[model samples]
Target: MKEKYLSTRRTYRESVRPHDGEVRFQVAVEQTDLLIVAQEDLRHEIASFVFQVRGEIKNWILFHPEFAESLSPVIVDDGAPEIIRAMAQAAALCDVGPMAAVAGAVAQAVGDFFSPRTPNILVENGGDTYLHSTRERVVALLAEPDSGAVVGLGIEAEAFPVAVCASSATIGHSLSLGAGDLVAVRAQDARLADAAATALCNMLRSEADIASVLERAQILAEFGVEGVFAQYNKKIAAWGNVELVALN
Candidate 1:
């Protein structure tokens, strides 16, 4: 299995922090490195939740090794834990493996765990995020290396508790069959966003594939997908309510 590394760029988070009065912190454990933003510094609560969720996932994977290693969706029993079930659902939706949704699933679980206590919460696992904010938030896109582009999406405040997940073929250790530099998806939940991003990236083999990918992505809008953004060879394409903006 490929080891997961920290894929999220902190510069974007730092640039947008002033708009929201949320405190930011980091929690690292094994393969998981989470960048969390909340109303207050809740390191203890964050640590407890991360460990418990990670443990449950690790234990389930141990019992069902196929779930962790499969590149295709596997049937999960109803008796599985909520997180496990969520992973299965996301994988099935995108026709990918359950592990593809791991980061987003974990982020969503943590966000849900603290939603009642915090009015605004943002949890980023790798490049996948679970965001719930009272005000609009702009999440920057860190797509190519050494590129002079400052692209991002201006998510409306009404779109709170949405997931913005990214997948890349030129970056990170995740498995992808496409050549897209970055593919981001917005959904009602992080798990679906993460899985869909991976599935979309896998279809984008070249610049010519952008249109078809966008069409497929638009079909997901009915499934709570707010938008889709993809960049390849300096060419960018987007569909749905994606508020693209350039930062100074």
Candidate 2:
């Protein structure tokens, strides 16, 4: 797995800004760029949580460098922090490294911190997201080069608190062996979504690989993945309960 450096970008946060009465804010700390939305201004609280989670994860990484460096799944101790355990388990399920789930795990942590105080919350770390909304939410798909094209997701309000994480080989700093434009995964937790996205993208090198990859993605259902959406060479495909919508 490649661990390339990524800078904070506003394009994705701006593209997915919710119009459903939710307030949005951006927070950048280190390599984690977050787009947090809620019923009210909770930027301070969200930032605090993000910092705490990042601190814990950083400490864990310091103790276990292998967890951060391994490209393959690793077995972590039961005493690991909740975020670390979540990442480890998600990585194991997707057969990727724990770091692959870092963004989603962090997003989920922030979401969990505010889910009790508010019924509607969205925490996006990098491109991974943990969202809970009182109204239907539309998540835009902004893959590389095809930025102007209209492709997105129509997520129901009832499916609030779900994780929608994406990975790409053609873009972003994440390590992927394949050459897919994008791989999006929806699951009960952001960790699984993130890791699965990376794993799936690493498997898709061409449009012809879609069928087999989609077949393999079916097994992810057992790991709490609800659906998958992929774009490769301008071709799009979806599986499970994902509802594709056009933004333009």
> Residues 1-248, candidate 2, lDDT per residue (tens digit)?
32332543446565656566778888777777788887788877777777888899899889889999999998988998988998999999999999999999988888887888877888877678888778888877767533543777789988878888988876667778887888899887899999999999889888998886788789988878999998887688999979998886
Model 1 scores a TM of 0.92
Q: State TM-scores per candidate.
A: 0.92, 0.93
Residue by residue across 1-248, what tens digits does model 1's lDDT show? 22233354544545545344678888877788888888888878888889999999999999999999998999999999999999999888788999999999999999988989987888888778888888888777768534433887888998788888999887777778887888999887898899899999998888999998899898776666789999887799999878998876
> Model 1 misses residue 68 by how many Å?
0.8
Q: For each candidate, what is the lDDT?
A: 0.84, 0.82
Evaluate residue 87 in candidate 1 and report its C-alpha lDDT on the 0 to 100 scale: 91
Best by lDDT: 1
Q: Return the lDDT, model 1, position 208.
A: 96
Candidate 2 residue 118 Cα shift, in angstroms, is 2.1
**What is candidate 2's local distance difference test score?**
0.82
